[model samples]
Structure formats: structure tokens, C-alpha cells
Target: MTIAEGCILVACLLPIACAWIAKSKGFGKPRRDGGFDNHSPRQWLASLQGWQARANAAQLNSFETLPIFIAGVLVAEHQQASQPLLDALAMAFVAARAGYIGAYLADWANTRSILWTLGLACCIAMFFIG
Candidate 1:
């Protein structure tokens, strides 16, 4: 598969991984008070959202990388793209995503948002440039 495809795969898997981790940690299970149910789909979604401050950043980072990946593929297909550049951007995207997740989990709102924007710009740039 192409690097772009691989990056997309990673983007899809990251959220699943986070959800599974949350479930394993008892984030989605029903509460004993009978007022809150954990096993419900809503509960799971809510749990995910509860982690949103962090999860949102991670999601942004993942999606932000998509455009650059797409752009790289398009350029490569046209024989005008540098493999090294694509590799570097891909690596940066992944690293930024990891940092985004960490910052989000830590509730570092400002920094996380800044990083998220950077990644988003990458994707937006690719969409127009490609």
C-alpha cells in the first residue's frame, strides 16, 4: 500500500485504540447508581466525549495529516514529489498526533489547540495544493 493509504489506516485505528483503552479502563461501563449506564452506546459515546478535550486534539491531528498524505500521493503519481519530503511529513504528522494526544490528555488546551491547527493547516494546504 502507498504511504497515504498507510497513514489513513493509522488515522482510522487510532480512535479505535483509544476507545478500547477507555473501555478496558471502565470508562463506558454502567454506574452502580442506576442513574448512569455504562454499557449503553450513548454511554460509550459520552465516555469518548468526556475525553474529548484530548480526543479532539488527537482526532484533529489524525485528520490534519490526511491532506498532506493525499498531496504526497498525488505528486508522487505525477513524478514531482520527493519521497524524502513525504516521509518526513508523514513522520511529523505521526509525531504531532502523538504529542497532541498527550497534550490533550493532560488538558493542555492552548498548546494542544495550536498543534492541532498546525496539523489541520497541513491537510488544508494539501487539499488546495494537490
Candidate 2:
């Protein structure tokens, strides 16, 4: 597989990492004691606060952005866009996403938004890469 395709896999997994960050504090404890309730995971996540809450929010945003990124890469590949350029954009998208997640966790709202926009731009650019 190409590096761009590999980036798609990494992009897909990022939300899981964010989810882990959101629920980490609740791990290894009983559900009744405010631990992560796998039985009602959504509810548990919804109850998060501060950086954890932001992490969950970022997870949702990551999931939301994934489809476009996937489509962008696939469409670019099918259109015979430059392989190296496609790979570079894909990598940039991932980097921007990582920055977004970090900014979210750190409560840097403006930085997070900027990174999010950069990621989206990368995806949009890929769509016309051919």
C-alpha cells in the first residue's frame, strides 16, 4: 500500500486514541465509582469534563472529518494525482490532526481551530490534486 493509504489507517485510529484519553481517568475502577462504564460508554464519555471532555469532543470531530479525508485521498489516487504529493498531503493532514488533538487537550481553542482548518484544507486540496 502507498503511504497515503497508510495515512488513512492512521487517521481512522486517531479517534480511538482521543477516546482513550477521554476515558483514561476512569479506567481500572468500578463503574459505580465513576469509572468508565463500558456498558454505557457514550454516557460515560458524555460525562467528561475539562481536558477529558475536550478530548472526547476532538474524537467526535476526528470521526466527522475522516470521511472527507478518505474520499479526498481515494479520489486523488483514482485521478492519477502525483503520488508523492498525495502522500505529502496525507501526511500533513495527519500532522494537523495531531496538532488539533494536542491543542484541544491543552485547551488552546484557537490553535485547535486553525489546525482543524489546515487538516480540512489538506483534504480539499487532495481532491483536486490530479
Candidate 3:
């Protein structure tokens, strides 16, 4: 796979990382003692608060943004866009997404939004590159 394609894989895994963050504190403990309850995962996740809650929210947003990013990369590749430019944009999108997750986990609302926008712009820019 190309560098851009590798970036797509990285982008796809971001949400999983966020989800892991959301559940990190609850790992390796009993469910009754506030551990990650696999039986009722949604309920357990719903009960999260603070940074964990934000992580969950970030995970959802990551998932929501993934389709567009994937589409942009695929469409750009199909159109024979400049490989280096496409790769750069894809990498930028991944970096922005990582920053967005960090900002979310840190409760930096404005920074998170800015990073989110940057990621989106990267995706949009991909469609125009050739």
C-alpha cells in the first residue's frame, strides 16, 4: 500500500484508540467495582464522565469524520492526484485527528474544534489535488 493508504489505516484506528482511552481506567477490575462491563458496554460507556466522556465523544466524532476522509483519499487516488500531495494531506489529516483527540482528552474545547476543522480541511483539500 501507498503512504496515503497507510494513513487511511491510521485514521481508521484513531477512534479505537479514543475508545480505549474512554475505557482505560476501567480495565482489569471487576464490573461491580466500576470496571469496563463488557456485558452492557453501551450502558457502561454512557455512564462515563469527565475526560472519559470526552474521549467517548471524540471517538464518535472520529467515526463520523472517517467516511469523508476515506472518500477523499479514494477519490483523489482514482483521479490520479499527485501522490506526494495526497500523502501529505492524508498525513496532515491523521495528525490533526491526533491533536483533536488530545485536545478533547485535555478538555481544550477551542483547540479541539480547530483541530477538527483542520482535519476536515485536509480531507477536502485531497479532492482537489492532482
On lDDT, the leading prediction is: 2
Preferred candidate (TM-score higher): 1 or 2: 2
For model 3 the local lDDT of residue 100 reads 95
Steric collisions counted per model:
2, 0, 0
TM-score of each: 0.62, 0.98, 0.98
| Residue 75 lDDT in candidate 3 | 95
Residue 116, candidate 2: C-alpha displacement in angstroms = 0.5
Give candidate 2 misplaced runs (Cα > 4 Å).
none
Per-residue lDDT tens digits for candidate 3, residues 6-106, read: 99899899999999999999999999899999999999999999999999999999999999999999999999999999999999999999999999999
lDDT per residue for candidate 1 within 1-130, as digits (tens), equals 6565476567556656544443444444456533334447455445444564345445545554555556655665466455555545555655566666767777788877787676565544443332
Worst 10 residues of 1 by lDDT: 121-130
Compared with the true structure, all predictions reach lDDT values of: 0.56, 0.97, 0.95
Evaluated against the true structure, the overall lDDT of model 1 is: 0.56
lDDT of 3 at 34: 99
Ranking of candidates on TM-score, top first: 2, 3, 1
